[model samples]
Target: MSEALLEGGTRCLRNVLGRFATGVVAVAAADPADGTRAGLVANSFCSVSLEPALVSFCVAHTSGSWPLMRGAGLLAISILGAQQRAAADRLAASGTDKFHGLPWISSPGGAPVLEGSLAWLECTVEAEHPAGDHTIVVARVRALDAIADGEPLLFYRGTFGGFSR
Candidate 1:
């Protein structure tokens, strides 16, 4: 494709991808020393392995929490349920007490596992690659749990919804 076409193609791709629904997840981490921690809602997560246990998520290069989470040594991937959109929004906010009024349980690795999620997966960053305006983070799952029975929160066309069947 020509350069002009490539730019237009990217825009088209973005619009096309928006039509596909995705599950929401929160990638959280804690600093064991000072107990400082943070998390953010992400619709860009997926399982990558099972034998060695691994998963991956993408974060915008400009995210402030990415630096903190990278330094924490471990991250908690909290798969949000359809009812946890508020939790997602809270985490997605910047420069705020993201954990305020949030209910969570502590993992063995000291990460916060938010309650009422479809599941929680604890991981340690194994690899990070710069991908355009985002960073692709590959983590090795350290600990996890399918803690609840519920439908996932879905993101599509800039809105939240859930499966009907």
Candidate 2:
């Protein structure tokens, strides 16, 4: 395959995949000792197993927040609601404090659970595997709860929106 062909193929793959809409989430954690926090927005969250209460999300290898959150031992996954688009944008941005103006409460395990999220899951990293440009994180759900009732924030075709009945 020629270089131009490979580049075009990669873009095509991304465009094709973007056709599938997905819900957005904030994957975050706080250092128990210092209360430092790290987080990022991800639309790739998924359930892996029910028997072990496992969930998974992908983080890009270049993500600055992942390294900080990874060492926290505990992580929180907050399901973003349709009204939380600003929060999502902040978390997805680079080189800034993701939680600076975001309201959140710490989970029992010291993970930051964003307030106003539709639901939240407290988890611990069970395993990680490198996949191309991203790392797949499998987590064991220690605890979880639905916090609010609302439409989920979604991403489709490179844009974000809410579902309609």
Candidate 3:
């Protein structure tokens, strides 16, 4: 209940959760009107349902890019491959152009889909719920495809790597 206990608990929770390996994804979108792009890398992406074709990802409340991307109407989730670690790092960083030199193409729905990704999904925002430090976004998939055959870029123990067969 004390401040010190709360701080320690937070740190511990993060450390504990880091043990679960997760695939990394880039959630991105382009403004249909002006061509501006916004994106962020996330390892908190997962399938939420199959009946209605839904997916979800978590975005930090502190992320400056989320607001811009959120209003873009449609979004693309690119499943990163091992070769795209640089792309992940660039998207994860703040205070700079995340797509300056990033090679990407627009999805059918006008969202930015990073090149060299293993797969991609274009979706529209279905719902958003406020979590502790992040917003849980549920998306309705409009289009999706497996782009290439490769191992996925993964995050584990606070670091990025690829899984081996």
Provide the TM-score for each candidate, comma-separated: 0.92, 0.94, 0.94
lDDT by residue (1-165, candidate 2, tens digit) is: 656557778787777789999999999999878989999999999999999999999999999999989888999999999999999999999999778978998887779999999999999999999999999999999999999899999999999998998
Could you give me the TM-score of model 1 versus the true structure?
A: 0.92
Displacement of residue 42 (Cα, Å) in model 2 is 0.4
Model 2: residues with Cα > 4 Å off, grouped in runs: 1-7
Model 1: lDDT to the true structure: 0.89
Between candidates 1 and 3, the one scoring higher on lDDT is 3
Model 2, residue 46: C-alpha shift (Å): 0.4
For 1-165, candidate 1 gives per-residue lDDT tens digits of 557557778776777788988999999988878988788889899889888887888999889998998999988889999999889889999989999899987877889888888898889999998999999999998888898888889999888998888
Model 3, runs deviating above 4 Å = 1-7
